[model samples]
Target: MMRLTRRTEYGLMALAWLARAGGRFHSVREITENLDVPRRLLAEILKDLSQAGLVEAVRGPGGGYRLREDPGRLTLGRIVNVLEGPTIFAECYQGDCDLSPRCTIKRGIGEVARRLEAVLEDFTLEEVVHGPAGAPAPSPSS
Candidate 1:
């Protein structure tokens, strides 16, 4: 099964929180305390997102982090790419596979990966915050 690392998961959670907050600058302490994420790790994730241009970091007393773009413009795939590098669906599809030219399984997995990527790309941060009716919002507590 595919799984996102805690870093990516928490990063997305934090972004969703910021989006829900309407792009307000929230400090690391506030985020960690409210979301129950580890402060140090969350800080690193915020730094990475900021460097990727997905988040804007503010300095000084009342400063913190906020989304750089509108939630509707941010895709899940882009966020994943920023936080976790590239999405690799299978180890055998990494180009170093022993059956690189002969494996149908690799091709199939690659196709699935592409489809999944497309779906992820289609999902924006806004969708995550609101979710579908009856579906709970994405939150650290949930």
Candidate 2:
């Protein structure tokens, strides 16, 4: 069963929180408090996002983190890739398959991976923050 890692989930949560802030900086403490995420993990996730150029880290008294690009322009796939690396959600495709030499299901797994990517590609950060509507309200309750 494929699933989003805790790190990716935290990254998305942090992104949506920042998105709701409307370009304002929010500290890790604030984000974790609002989302009930762990401080250490959330900090690492934010650092990864900052290094990936999705969010900018500000330095000063009010310094924190801000989105580098429009939330709408950022894709879920991009975020996942940044936090988790290129994911197939399966070890087989990552060259960890011990049955590769005799496996007959590789082709089907590849197809499944492609379909998953296609679906993920359709979802943008904006959709994650605001849903399908142009603007409503951010839901970081998750």
Candidate 3:
């Protein structure tokens, strides 16, 4: 039952839309209206993205949001980490686990999470918005 949280989904969608604008400032209202997303939620997501240094926010009447970094270099894993923190494939992987001394598969699960992160890091924002053919996503080992 693993799936992306709403915050992550909205963040990605907003980023993809912003990527389409070619770094132009896009207002929250504009994005919400076009994407049919909740205004408050989108605003919060944008704020998180802004704080993450992924997007730049401009103030004043002619202000909005624009991509600060190149989408082609940004990875989904980086965005997820910024919005949702690190990915935990298993609860026992946490260092505070009481059974850490006797636990088995802990390292294996850690490896799973690590490999998953590596796979996600391979995908850039440009590939998310456009086609994967634009740039090759990295493999689990790469």
Q: How would you encode candidate 1's per-residue C-alpha lDDT over 69-120 as one tens digit per residue?
A: 9998999999999998987777776777775566668767777878989999
Per-residue alpha-carbon lDDT of candidate 3 for residues 1-142, written as tens digits (9 for 90 to 100)? 3588998998898898888766468889888877878899999989988988999999778789999989989998899889888776777776666766788877678777778778889999888987756564332120
Model 2 misplacement above 4 A:
89-98, 132-135, 138-142
At residue 9, candidate 1 shows an lDDT of 93
- Can you write out model 2's per-residue Cα lDDT over 97-129, one digit (the tens) per residue? 886688877667877888898788889988988
Q: Which residue runs does candidate 1 get wrong by more than 4 Å? A: 91-96, 99-102, 133-142
Q: On a 0 to 100 scale, what is the lDDT of residue 121 in model 1?
A: 98
| Candidate 3: 10-residue stretch with minimal lDDT | 133-142
89: Cα error in model 1, Å: 1.7
TM-score for each prediction?
A: 0.84, 0.84, 0.86
| Local distance difference test, each candidate | 0.86, 0.83, 0.83
TM-score, candidate 1, is 0.84
**Candidate 3 Cα outliers beyond 4 Å, as residue runs:** 134-142
lDDT of 3 at 1: 33
Per-residue error for 77 in candidate 2, Å, reads 0.5
Candidate 2's TM-score reads: 0.84
